[model samples]
Target: MSPLPRFGRIADGPPAPAGGGESFATLLAAGGARVERIASLAQADPPGAWYDQPGDEFVLLLQGAARLGFAGGEERALAPGDWVVIPAGCRHRVAWTDPARETLWLAVHLPPIAGRGAIADQ
Candidate 1:
């Protein structure tokens, strides 16, 4: 069998199904860490819902726009090139994403308990 291609484009994934929120594909996973390519099309977290993930997430906005909400009522708007480091166990949600076009994101997820310190050490 041929080896997996080492180079790929973030926009190569298929779009989300109609009204199907976001789409994600694992690009790489190794040593307790995984990288993913996420695509959003006018998606937002349901009202009052929050994602309390077990692993930390580092996300980079590649195209379009988005808004993120935190548990303490803090919010941030992201544009192309903007990135955020969300600590594990942090309550957060995607408040909004542009509906006019597909929004792309590059996300990195690390194992539980291997949070901020692991990031700093790398």
Candidate 2:
């Protein structure tokens, strides 16, 4: 037996953030892996704030544009169709996002692999 199919649109639910914030929608979850849709509108992390996750994150820019900043001072600009895999323990933060329009992102959180701190190319 298998689970039933699930369908959804990233923009189907939740309006853009009012004022300044981000909206998250969980699309799937199995075991320790999860998929999410993140909608951002004129939102960014507070100064000096960084996200250091215990697991790896694969993110794709679905719509709009944004920039990511790393703890080492490297910044990467993202546009539609752009994707990046952030390894566990990598300090990062959202530096900028399209403020005039909604910025949509598809993020996949991968279960942490013991003894590995980075993701290798397949």
Instruction: Please list the residue runs of candidate 2 whose C-alpha ends up more than 4 Å from where it truly belongs after superposition.
Output: none
The C-alpha TM-scores of every prediction are 0.85, 0.93
User: Candidate 2 lDDT, tens digit per residue, 1-122?
Assistant: 99798777777867567786799988889889999999998878987999999899999999999999999899999999999999999999999898999999999999989999888778
Candidate 1 per-residue C-alpha lDDT over 23-120 given as tens digits, one digit per residue, 9 for 90 to 100: 98999999899999899989899979999888889999999899999998998999999999987888899999988888899999988873253334
Q: What is the Å distance of residue 11 in model 2 from its true position?
A: 1.9
Number of clashes found in candidate 2:
0
- Deviation of model 2 at 85, angstroms: 0.5
Candidate 2, lDDT over the whole model:
0.90
* lDDT, residue 35, model 1: 96
Q: Which candidate's lDDT is highest?
A: 2
- Candidate 1 residue spans exceeding 4 A from truth: 1-5, 114-122
Worst 10 residues of 2 by lDDT: 11-20
**Candidate 2 Cα deviation (angstroms), residue 12:** 0.9
